[model samples]
Target: MSYAGALWLAVQEDLYTGICNGTRENGDINRPKIIREESKGCLECFDDYFLSQCFHLSRPCLTFLLDFIKTRLKKNVFNPVSDSTSTESIILATLFFYAHGFLPSKITAKLGLNHTFAGEAVNTTSKILSELSSSFITFPASYNDRMGVAQGFKNISGIPNVVGVLGCFHVKVTPPPSELSLFLNTLGYPSVTVQMVSDVDGNLLSVEQCYPGGTREQYVWERSTICQEFVSFRHGQTWVIGGRGLPPGRHVLTPVERSQLKTSAARRFNITHSRVMTYNQHVFGCLKARFQCLNDLGTVQADALESVACIIKACCVLHNISKKFSVPLPREPVLEPVHPTQDVKGKEGEKSFYYMEETREDMIETCFGQIRDEEEKEANTEGWL
Candidate 1:
């Protein structure tokens, strides 16, 4: 080639390379530079409030979490050598991501971490918590435990034999390429339905399962393992209370129709039922409030559905852990679940409905029948006097 032509080609190549590496001001994307935090000393400087502000966990709870998962995190999340990121930093970064819906790049910049470690930390941390879900978020299986939960519910709501409050909530997600309709909720947005059972104190007893955003709540419950347990009478003599929409069974109770509330006793019963049912609302509110990641799962995609589910389970486990340590919920606005307008009938058939209706009648008679008799007796005495 001629020297002049070769020189021209070289000049063009240099200009292209310069453009590729140019700053954002020059109409090119500038890659963020990582500034690694090498010293463990920085961690010592953060007070409890600051730690909670960043990670949404108290110091002792954070310590407990670190101690609880440090060994596994060391093995799974961090390398022994050549990985300078401390276990605490990784956890803090992951929790920061969960507490705030920050992008990985922002997290890296804030915590002095690289993109790779930040991503791995979130994945590993969620996996670890998901694995611990069975331990942390458990439904009472034993008779004694079930009874204790029942007693707690009765004390709080004055409703007898309510072992848990059953409900479902929605979490936003980006729809996948395949089966896109499954992820779109009734409100015309992509989401996943999280079915849950919570005890009186808003602690989750079971995260029964996650379903496609568009799945019906009644369908999810009918297929839920807890509902099966109830159907089989595995948790004997204990029934959960929910909205009138749920198909009531011998082990589950729902309020009567609005027409049935004509009597004062029936009105009282429905009010009490509502009081108990709202605990499920409280559980969802506190869970989402405590871990904002459940509110914004940006890292999640359609292909990684299982990962997102795990992350949700992990947040639930963390929620229970926070409750265990008495961690106060952050001061955030709690979003209420939308109530169903129409009733949802289960596939359990009419026979099951009659069976549960009988139980509800018996409960009402036991609770309010004597009061009615007393009122009549007092009226008679007043007339005589």
Candidate 2:
């Protein structure tokens, strides 16, 4: 049987057994009564596709996530009133809110619960998950982990020693009451800029969301804690690739400009660099597609910037978890191309430019030189023939 069908059978079996309590509440007479058994039936009947659609996660992932966070939730979320709400319900409510960007009232209405309960559940769940961010989104600390990351990127485009793709995503938030300009990004929307480093499969290795939307990418990177950690990666001979506009550093490589390509090796390097960046782009696309809340969190209260940050972080944790299960996106993700910028402003920026230029050149020679030499050798052989 399919997973959903098997789950239905299990729920049916549970109904006959004494495992489920028959107690149910109908706070709203217009809404259908929800009991322990029915809730299991509803969730279990979710085939993988529908599960991913409603919750932005597959059954395997949802199951794993619940088990993973169960101990933490019990310790933190258990209370007199909350005892009635199952862990599954809390997760389902939070996932629905994240996937649909629905208000707590709407989510509770759909789940046949009161607004207070649903709102609390959503907040508590998001808070709990956000607290678990370090567990889900982690940088490769061990040598083997770093090597694995490097190998994954090397497989992508023959790029050597790349541990992650450095990128940023703009999360739309409601216009704040004060200093509104701080939240407005280049797109003229009130947003929060989230810096992230994604692996080859688009799983986030590091996440930082301390900056306002209008903050410069370079400024965020320079001040980020991960930036310091990457200096260690550089010492380990592992680096990350960033997109256009960001100045490269000892631990970061950016795509060389087309005009600056002096050889076939450089041209190929640029193409490959662009291709690798698409992985980063795909990640943002998938993230927003799965958790629509990130697309526009404008409904949030103006003063709830901390809540917004928590929600974004929780969504990122969920994104990485969904990626763990290999959950397919419900729709095609829109990928934005990397755009170049000449706004390298500062002494540090200038130094990074020159330093990474040499690094990029060395990479071009080390990684692609052999292929270029082979091409030349083939041309000579053809000429002889």
Candidate 3:
């Protein structure tokens, strides 16, 4: 190579490098900067629909949740080592992973996190949310609370003293590790059962999840915390209405036999009872509708039965929080489940009226809060002036 050519080449190389690096002042070194957040491509599901679909909430609701979490929960990383991933990013990414049912592998690129980190985010977020469930999902433990729930149900259905409605549904998912056989429903699909107790407005009062697909709704409800403490009858005559499968018990009641009972009162009872019970379907429909991840029917896979249950409990907590914040659920009413056989014949329990009595309206009005347990009686007597 000629000396002149070598000089020219060196000059050109320096100029090219200078142009690429821009000007460096003082001790600063000009180099290509790493883009941490925005450098990773954004997803189309990052807009309004993303917020609603991923978080099952709007901006305001997300803001509320974020604030609550940040305030109450410790700011901790999914892993002990500090990465560029922010706490906010971890939370948002975990929510997306859950809502979309994305595997940690798929969640990595979207969140600018590594595969293991994404997996960590999912675990930590669900654990934190489940721990916070008590603050959000609660049953009526006090008399005032019971009275309010009872009144709310009564107003909606005109079935006085109605406390809440019970229902259950199957959430399809990839089979869990150990109990793959137990997760299979009669329909020959793998699923897990989620039992819910909802008030008039589709607000979840109690959520019992993690049971196998074959688990009966009645069995789940019977084993739930709410059932043991439920004062079925508040106003002597008004009682907690159960799905057809749940036979009448001390703390619970189901409608009369429809085929055997043929009377105006029976029809009226069925109609009114159905009105309140319909929300049970509405709650599940709205939940699955809002959060598509919960409705996987088969696409989204659950890591384990426990993990899925944790997510469900978190969802129930969030659902109650949304209701408390007056977040409107799905607008249209979900139709009641159809059945050709006996009660609870379908996956969704559709409550149809059977029988109660010829007339109980006047009796209900006079007996508002007449029935009382020993504890309540003592408290009532103590407060009596």
Candidate 4:
């Protein structure tokens, strides 16, 4: 039978049973004599069923739940509990009334109690439930530890790459700044620096939040140091650090070479009008433009921008590794042209695309130059030279 049919039959059976059990006059069960109108006792019957199912005070789970309620009450965490009238029956009655969205008068009439008692019970129970919900339903620390870094890189996708592709293309809503601040505050640091890491699939691998009470540069330095340490300990793969320059060979382009590639990519991707000026800007803009172009050209959405970000991040990790090992990079891989084609399923065929060797080289050079310029300015100001 249909669910509606079954529900109707059940309702009929309940009504029949209620009629067989005649109303009592003195025990708050009889229809009020003053009304002299036919009343169905629907509220009372609903209250009885709901209370019977939900309020089993003798059950272990109920006992545990009540214990939590009592503890919060003793802590004076709830305003309702602070105003006295803290009985188990009142708590249960309050829970029932609020759970069903009943007014105090309605609840009192249904449960055979005074309106004042019902009101007090509801107020106290609501406060307790509120506190419980707030304190109990929280994301675990491990979830933050795992997801924090991945979210940062996801944001980086909006920053363009040398190929005019959106490197971190995956749309991810990060935790609000206030929430991040609260999380940092809980770390018991005057100031914290966070280094985020992601995998080839744009999955967040780890987040290292460090205490570095200093200037912005100092914080960045400390976080980089922490990132280096984490990479060394976790991956042990030498090709995982930043700022060491791209893999060496004719195939790989240096910063200057990558700048040319960016200009070419911008033109090819119809983004020449955007006119990305700086190397950093070019790198950021190219990736963003490329993704849009790819989407337009393929007539399909490519969800691999974040994956590209991960690949770049992983290469940065290798640069860090090179610094740690004091070793030069290996030869660059041969570049292969990836052709766009529509498969039988009307989807873009899978193809291999290479990062322009010069693009990464330029990024490292730009980073180093900025660092050196800052150091030089600091030295000249201090007259140490």
Query: For each candidate, what is the lDDT?
Result: 0.71, 0.72, 0.59, 0.32
Best by lDDT: 2
* Candidate 4 lDDT score at position 60: 39
Q: What is candidate 4's lDDT per residue for 1-385, written digit by digit as tens? A: 1123245335434433443354334654422222222343222233333322333112333344556566666665444344222444455555433222233343344344577766655555544554342233221124343244324322433212211111111111222344433222212322222233323222223322222212132233233533344234332211222211222222212223333544433222222212221222232222222112111111111222232233223223322222333332122212111111111111122111134344444544453345556877999989964
Candidate 3 residue 233 Cα shift, in angstroms, is: 9.4
The number of clashing residue pairs in model 1 is: 0
Cα deviation at 313, candidate 3, in Å, is 0.9
lDDT of 1 by residue, 1-385 (tens): 1123245334324433433344223442322222234453334444455456556788778878877776676666344422434666677777776776553464464456688877876777788888988899888899889889889987776668788888877788776567668777767777877788899888888896677777877788788888888777888888888766566667777887786666666677787888778778878887777777778575345455777787788889988999999987776547557655444754736464466686787787677566678899999999999
Model 3 clashes, total count: 2
- Tens-place lDDT digits, model 2, residues 126-191: 878889999999988888988988998898789888889888788777774676787766667777
Ranking by TM-score: 2, 1, 3, 4
Off by over 4 Å in 4: 1-60, 74-86, 104-113, 143-385
Which portions of model 2 show Cα errors greater than 4 Å?
1-42, 45-50, 77-86, 104-106, 110-112, 232-235, 257-259, 299-304, 337-342, 347-356
lDDT of 1: 0.71
Model 3 vs. true fold: TM: 0.67
Question: Compared to the true structure, candidate 1 yields what TM-score?
Answer: 0.79
Q: How well is each residue in 190-256 modelled by candidate 3, as lDDT tens digits?
A: 7788777777767777777578776656667767766655534323434667767665554455665
